[model samples]
Target: MEKLQSPARDIHPDTRNGLHPVTLLNRNNLTLLDTGTSAEQFLQQKISNNIAQGHQDAFYVADLGDIKQKHWRFMKELPRVKPFYAVKCNSTNEVLQMLATLGTGFDCASMGEIDMVLRMGVPAADIVYANPCKQVSHIKYAAAHGVCKMTFDCEAELFKIAAFHPKAEMILRIATDDRDAWCALSSKYGALVEQCEDLLKTAKNLNIQVIGVSFHTGSGCKNTHSFCKAIEDARKVFEIGKKLGYQMRLLDIGGGFSGNSEFRPTFEEFADVIRQSLNQYFPNNKEVEIISEPGRYYVESAFTVALNIITKKEVYEKGADGNSRRKFSYILNDGVYGTFLDFYLVKEKQKLKPLLGKDFATEQELFPSNLWGPTCTNVDKLVNEFYLPELETGDWVIFPNMGAYSISMSTTFNGFPQPKVYFVLSKGDE
Candidate 1:
């Protein structure tokens, strides 16, 4: 990975606070905001400058202020539910550091994630092993580190936890109505509602402590009723646990919050549904505490990618009516194997805007185009059948809202290197 660096030399008046001013630097060391340009315009200028400086391939811009804004919005809208930032989604050190400084908890799935959080000075109690299936070594590592809060969905997991970490606080994961979710996990995780009691009884028999219930309606869920219905089901399990002489004190509403703005259910809208559901199901309970595992909500919009167009080819093919049709295909430096797996994994079409090009004049014509990555395989295509301004070989494309699964999902396949990441902070960060 190669980073583009420039000498800092510009002072921009701080709109966030009256007392302090921020200095914005472009890739050419140009100061922003002083020229009366909006932030988006400054970003465009930065991208242009970096490409001119021969630093063009693919790079990620991580804005700390955007993360802070998401954190503020989450706290304001869903104050009752404490968020444990899901480590599996974009666990960049900068992101983890920001969340850690903000005093947020973490939901780790593997030993590496837990170790990363712990190395940041977070307490073991603030970490939860949310993956239902556990490796024996991972269980021992969690026990050795004093991170014992975990979730389970079956009897096998109970025995494994009892043998490895007998004192672990177990949360029963129940299946939810994930039919409407973009990436449903009910088939792979979460025990059925009918099996909840038997699972709890088995835990009791094994001397394992069952303390609460957890459920994920699925990733990027747009349905509001899923949460409400899931909460209702969790309440039923709570009653079952109470009848089993177990004290239930925690409710882990696993992640489903969407960060893609163009998609359904804004953060505020999802929070409203969750707020009403919590009020109805677990209202004003002093003994019970509610927490959520949100992965994309904090870092999704904070990231953007700028990629260099490597080549473009114009093609003529026969149409269905026996007429010849013309179209253009573009190959970029990065593709589905690097920072664009979501486009393949979730059918997520990233917002692509031309940043630098010769034919970008106001009256420039648009054409039917297909975008691809610089990989040998045909699966490296990024966009299919999108109308874009006619671009040349040296042009650039910017992808916004790419922080969620891009970095974490990137691979070194086809000998392609991951793009270098550049951090831009709106304010001072410790």
Candidate 2:
């Protein structure tokens, strides 16, 4: 039998009283941390996102050493905007528990997610079955569980829901063209504006209560205009509903909030754009409730993935002019199989920083390097070409702005177990 390589061990390059790569990378330069504080200690001081103590190695720890539970940033500038977390982002018990306690409702896409939220002690009324295409079984489940609200984009879905769950409250998911956004939702769900009247008539005939309208502009939307256009489209739907004597009570501006540190829009700024548009469309409609499904916005900047640097090599590649260009490569124990599957497989851009240990020496030794996961496949590379301080095997790296879609999207592709999660808590609360 061939000998298998052991998972990469943590590298300690030198012996000196220094900081871990995790700490150094998060310092003022990276802005991942406000001060040059240890990960454990920084986890302790914050109040709103406080993590409880003592479960560092557990698969699920609400408070990992010093991490806070509420590190997620809400829309501070638009405090009036309430966020309904898209559950598909990260449905882990710890993540769900933290969000639930924060008093945020859930935006569930399936009966399973609805069940999960209900199990967490969330009221059925607090969930929005946001998936436009739902299975008959899911419709039955939601109806049986008293989760009356859901989304639909077509007459077929409305009929399906009415057949299986006659009393279901519903929302019409309108399709908007957001060619400028990173990931548009038109390919998957929502109905065209022309079909709104027919869909509403069908809903009325089937006795399925049509109470609201919803639309998803798409994920990673850089153009704020996409949101404005969606609101405009939703207004048309509201007007149609009013003509049919159906008073729309809810407006779910679906999830598409980006949190990649490089592309992040402040919650306040985003809320301002959304709210301003809504007011223009439905001014003084205090009887109607405005809601948003924000997945990445709330959780993206809250956590960091601490990975162990395993191996390093310097290589050169041919440039456009056939010149040899040197580049460094640093392999780490965790990869796409663990927390970064999206970036690894989809070539999604991610931010990386070094986590130097306390006994390390010579910060100047760190160099620009490519990071790879522990898989034997060549495709297992996490960052194809990234700059970093010179680092050896056993050193650690911290990937911040990693709290949103990454965790929920992780897979066990290479058979490696998922990394442990720990929450930090605020100081005075503890």
TM-scores for candidates 1 onward, in order: 0.88, 0.79
Candidate 1, 1-430: lDDT as tens digits: 1111111112112333321122443222323222223334345555656655776667776776677777888899989988999999989877787787777899999899999889878899899899999999999999999998999999999999989999999999999999888788998999988999999999999999988999999988878889999999999999999999999999999986877676677878888989999999899768788999999888887787878888989989888999897778999999989888876877752344333322244445556788899989998887776766667787777777888888999998988999877665553222
Candidate 1 — which residues are off by over 4 angstroms? 1-42, 320-323, 348-359, 427-430
- Give all candidates' CA lDDT scores: 0.79, 0.66
Total backbone clashes of model 1? 0
Pairs of colliding residues, candidate 1: none
Candidate 1 lDDT: 0.79
Single out the weakest 10-residue window by summed lDDT for candidate 2. Answer: 1-10
Q: 1-430 in candidate 2: lDDT tens per residue?
A: 1111211122222323232222112111211222334444432222112222322221222222122323234444444456788999877666666566667889998878998889878888889898999999999999899998799998889778878998888999999876656666788888988999999998888877899899888776666767788888888888899899897888888877765545756544666787788788867667677777877765666666666666778787887999886677877777777777656543543344433332333333433457788788887776644444555665555555667667788777767777766554323232
Clashes of each: 0, 41
| Top candidate when judged by TM-score against the true structure | 1
